[model samples]
Target: MERIVLPGDVVWEREVFASGTWVKDGITYAKVPGMLRDEKFIPLEMAYRPKVGDNVVGIVVDERNAGYMVDLNLPYNGVIPTRKVRISLRLGGMVYGKIAFVDEVGNVDIGEVDKLPAGKLITVPASKVPRIIGKKSSMLNQIRDISGSSVFVGNNGYIWIGQKGNMQLVMKALDLIIRRAHTTGLTDQVAKYLDENR
Candidate 1:
């Protein structure tokens, strides 16, 4: 029978006592750069992680004089350049942009996707497009007012939303609106429901 060796246990061989150095119970741990010892390594979701030339959906978190912070659903926050956003976006309007840069830090900045009336370059589902536009452009107007974006809906189900000032923020707001609109009457019902529920 052999005894299990533990950390700090001594081994005597050939009348020579070799002091046991402290070793981890199972395996030796290695340190990787930019990683914590106790931190578990979790891979970023490919759907949420931005790849080169991959289109992404994000929302504006903070608007600053220099630029805006975008919630790209990544490990790091994305930055929206002032140049990429339009100058007419009011405090609450919707804007859309294209991913132009992704840094090692996971920051993604995009160029504004302008050129409205050119037709549908960004195509959403036919059913969902109506939700984006809303009834008689009611939802569309709400998106425009809050995101500071100009939204155009084509009969072909093509939606174009441009930024007024900083397209990044407006685009972010629009993304929220579109996603929520899928739940049916989420916009109007939410406010009314809140008033009633509370």
Candidate 2:
């Protein structure tokens, strides 16, 4: 059952947890304005919160003696320990990795990182990522096919576009997704847009 949920509204009574909701005892409650679909709450707007296993695209904003500080397009910066990487990262380099841990105070630890070559990076709202990726990477694959780029998406909202694609079309499709995400038949619309514009 899907419906518009507001802050503090009880989403479900069972012992389940999902994004944009809080669980107390066995009941799950909404933490923001969003739609509840398939027992998962998707907020209309949100900031990226570090979660274990979420892939991230970040910049090396600063470096410490032990590691580097990464700006993950989140309110808090992430730390990439030197032990996790095989090479030295420059102060302004890009790294792609998954979150290893989020401490109690919101400190993020990144792991399994690889440095990405410099290219175009697009940042969007975290709430829009699910729509951009679509179900089972459908929209993403479409974008990749349309543009001919090996696009990599970070759940935190940083989109990496490779050098070989129709970058303009990719950006346009992403904009179209943000504009029409809540509408039905969005996938169809994207396909049409791509077909007509190409």
Candidate 3:
């Protein structure tokens, strides 16, 4: 049975609380409406908010005197300072960078980026990245091996597929993973799909 909780609802003591949860005194409370699954609170819905150390795929939308303004696929644009950039990027160029910091006011700082080569870019929900990668990158490796494509999965949910063999199959597998991320036995399903199709 699933335990659905609303904001401010008191939870049992000693239960570990994850993000979107808080504890006051000896009791824990939900900070968002969600279901308790495997002792983790999975929110009903949420946005992809950038956090420090998150690798993201950003496009150079505009170049500023100080640096480049990157589109992080978020509400706010991220700034990649000139000093942090090792290579020059042109407008519309895509790069893989890490979020160095996010201020309290929600401004983001991007750093340590590498220019991506020409490839197909696919975007999925950031929350589904872990499932796509699977345990210790098992799923990712499977796709890479079967498709012969170099895959880069950003923490922000931007996936870059380089090289060309079985591109369609790769995209199909990724779509399946994203669409069914919440379902159980996903790894086995993906593996089976790949084997059968191959």
Q: Could you give candidate 3's per-residue lDDT for residues 108-154 as a string of tens digits?
A: 88988889888888888887887888899999999999888888888
lDDT of 2 by residue, 1-198 (tens): 668899989988886677778899888888878887776677887667778999899999998877899999887789998876656888988888999989988899899998888778999888888889989999999989987877888999998888786989999999999987767688889999999987
Q: Give the Cα lDDT of each candidate.
A: 0.46, 0.86, 0.82
TM-score, prediction 3: 0.85
For TM-score, candidate 1 versus 3, the one ahead is 3
For model 1, residues 47-132, the per-residue Cα lDDT tens digits are 23454554444455677876776544456756667765654333222335567777876667766633333212344433344455
Worst lDDT run of 10 residues, candidate 2, spans: 39-48
State TM-scores per candidate. Answer: 0.32, 0.86, 0.85
The top-ranked prediction according to TM-score is 2
Clashes of 1: 22
- List residue ranges in candidate 3 displaced over 4 A: 1-17, 24-26, 31-35
- Clashes (backbone N, CA, C under 3 Å), per candidate, total 22, 0, 0
